[model samples]
Target: MMLSARLLLAATALCCFATTFAISMDGFATGHKCRCLTTTSEVIPTRLFRRIEILAPGPHCGNIEILVTLKSNNVVCVSPDEKWIIELIARISRNRQQKKPEVFSADQHVLK
Candidate 1:
């Protein structure tokens, strides 16, 4: 009876471990998206600060997309697809300064 109990416990533990491994491999599991934080600031002039949301999956992290709607100019524009939202912000900064256009990586979903 003692031997059988030990074996049952061992099997249960193994099954739990396997289930956890499988879930982690799936990527973007439940409650995983809440780990990130976003901050918004006005770029001045016609553009107003807006919120950032993750539209699609990414490689290590995830693809961060920013939605900006200009209240004064009455226009809405979404940042182009990029690996990180920071790159898009950099481009906007350049444009604000009347500098050359910048390019950033568009690859979002990258499996581990």
Candidate 2:
């Protein structure tokens, strides 16, 4: 009887370990979770900034993550995908393109 009891206890411990491993590996069997924090105000950035990333929904988690990298290397997430946000991103893209410095040929150089 004692031998049978020991086997039962070992089996129970093994089952518990397996359950924990599965949960941790699969993230509760659902998927990875993603959380994004965005500003509530509609105030867009004025200075030039990096690309406006468009994050779509996926197994990573619910909602999207819009990362707005600024000139100061500050990253801000703009959630809700609002019309104004989209427009703002477009404006930044256009401005960055226009801000590119023009390239000149070697013949144009006259160094003293």
What tens-digit string does per-residue lDDT give for candidate 2 at 27-78? 5656466656445445565555566677788777557677777887877767
TM-score winner: 2
**lDDT tens readout by residue for model 1, 20-108:** 88754546565555233453443433225443334455644464545554545433334444334457667667888896565657876
Candidate 2 segments whose C-alpha is farther than 4 A from its true place: 1-31, 89-112
- Clashes per candidate, residues 3 or more apart or on different chains: 0, 0
Which candidate number would show the highest lDDT if scored against the true structure?
A: 2
Candidate 1 Cα misplacement greater than 4 A, ranges:
1-9, 24-61, 72-79, 82-88, 91-112
Residue 45 lDDT, candidate 1, scale 0-100: 38
Model 1 RMSD, rounded to 1 decimal: 14.4
